[model samples]
Target: MHQEGTRLPNEPVLKQKHKKRPIKTLFLEADEDHVAYQDSTNRFMKLVYVHEGYDLTQPRHQLINPHYFTGNYPGTDNEELWTEVLDYIDANYQPEQVYLSGDGAKWIKNGAAFIPHCTFILDRFHLRKYCKRAAVGIAGLDRTLYQWVLPGQMKFIRDYFTVRFNDLTVTASQLQSLKQAEKYLTNNVSAIKDNGLTAYHGCSAEGHISHYLSRRLSSRPLGWSSAGAQGVARTRIFQLNGGNITRFLQAEQRQASKQAKVTKLDRRLHFK
Candidate 1:
C-alpha cells in the first residue's frame, strides 16, 4: 500500500457530488474523540455529520442520508472542517435553515461562521448532566431545574445555588460540583434556551462518536502512533461511507504500477 509520509490517508472526497436539490431543514452534529498516542500524549479526531433529518417510521430512528467526516483536523479553530461541511451542504441541498447541535464546545459553536442561517443548540444530554450535578443531593430539584432550563429560567436556578452556598452547609466537593455546573449553564444559557425554542431532533453526536470513533480508535487497551491512528480513522470512515476496499486497493495498485513505469522510463532516459 502506498502511504503518504507520516500523514493521514487523504481526507475522504466524494467521487461525484450529489445532485443539487432543496431541503427544508438540515441537522448537523459535531464532536471529537480523545485518542491516546504511544508517546503518552492525546490527540482529538473531530467528527461532523450532516443529515436531512430523522426517519420516525423505522423502529429505530435513523438519519436520512447522513454523510460523515472524520479526521484529526488539527487546530482549535474548526473553520476548515466547517467549510467542508458547508460546501457539501451547498452542493447537495439548498437548506433554508441549518441546526447545529452539540455540547456547546467553542469549536462546535465556531461552525456558525461557515454555516449561514445556522442555529446553535445545546444538546439535552449535557444540559441534563450539568443540571443533575448542580442539583446533587437536593432531592427532586434536578428534575425541577431541567424544567426550568426549558423556559430559560436560569436566574432562579442560579439564585437557588447562591442561597445553598451561603445559607446551607455543604462539603467542599459538593460546592465544587455546584460551581462547575453553574459556570457551564451560565456560559451556554442562550444555547439552552434555543433548544427549547427550536424544532430540534435531539443531538446524537455522543452516540455517533461512540459508534464510529471509539469502537475502533480507543475502545481497547492499545496505543497508536499519530499517523497510524489517523490512517485507521480515515479507513474506518471510508468503510462506513460504503467504500469498497477491494476495488479501492485494485485501483491503487493500477495507479502505482503506472507511476512505476513512468519513473523507470525517466531513469532510462537520464542514464542515456
Candidate 2:
C-alpha cells in the first residue's frame, strides 16, 4: 500500500519537500459478484485501476487485486466497503486525478462521493444501452428500428445532452433511470467536454471490467469464497494492468535489493 502511494508523489509533498513529477490519471471500475459459500453467501466487490495508456515498460501498479470485503447477499449498504477502498487509494495511490467508469450501480455512485475531486464518467456502452432501451420503448421493439435507431439515437442523445444538458430536466416517467444517466455526463461537465466523447475515452474502463472481471466471474451464476474470490480477482486485475509474471519478478528483485542493503547497515552498526 505504501509503495502504491509512493508511485505518484503528492503535489504538496513534491512542491514543499520533493520535486513534483507528472501524475497520471487512474481509471477505476468496480463490481460485486455473488459467491455462495457452504454456510453463508459472500459478496465480493472488486476494484481495479488502469493507468491511462499504461504499457509494458512503464508499469504503474505493483498490486492489482480488487479490495474485498465480506457482506450478506443483496446487502443494502456498502458504505464501509467503499470507505475501505477509498482509504486504501488515498493512503497508497494518491492519484492527481481519478476517472471512474462503470455500470449504474448504487454503490458505485456512493463510492464517487468519497473521492470529491475525482472525475466520474459513465460507461459509454452502458449509456448506449439505456438510450437503446428508452428508444425501443418509444419506437417499438421492431428488429429493423432496434438496429437502426439504437445507435443513431444513442449518438443523438449524447450530442443533444452535450449541448443542452443544463436546459433539460427529468421529464421521463422513469425519473430514477434518467437521473442515473444524467449523473455521469453532468457530474463532471468540464472534464467531459475536455475529454470529449470519442470511442477511446469511456470504452477502456468498460472493456477492462467486461473483459477482465465480468466475463469470467459474473457471466454465469457461480459462487465463490471471499478470500479465494479476492485473490483471483486481484490476479486478473494485475494481469490487465500489465503487471505480468515478469513485472512480479522485477518487483521481487527490487525488494530483495532493499532488504539486503538494510541488513548490511544493521551488521555495520552492530560491529561499530
For model 2, how does the per-residue alpha-carbon lDDT over 1-272 read when each residue is reduced to its tens digit? 32331221111121134333344555565555544543565454444343343342535432232332222223444666556556556545556777666554666666667664566555656555655443323454234323433344445445544543344453555445445544543443443343353422343445545656567656766665554455555555444433454555467689999999999999999999
Indicate the residue-level lDDT of 124 in model 2: 52
Colliding pairs, model 1: none
TM-score for each model: 0.88, 0.47
Model 1 / residue 213 / CA error / Å: 1.6
Deviating ranges (above 4 Å) for candidate 1:
1-19, 266-272
* Shift of residue 187 alpha carbon in model 2, Å: 10
Point to the candidate with the largest lDDT. Answer: 1
Clashes of 2: 4
For model 1, residues 1-272, the per-residue Cα lDDT tens digits are 21432232233444585577887789999888999989998889888989888888987789988888877878778777787788778888888889999888888888965699898888998899998998876877888889987678978977888887885678888899988988888888888888765467788899999988899888987788877877777777766767666666677779999999999999999999
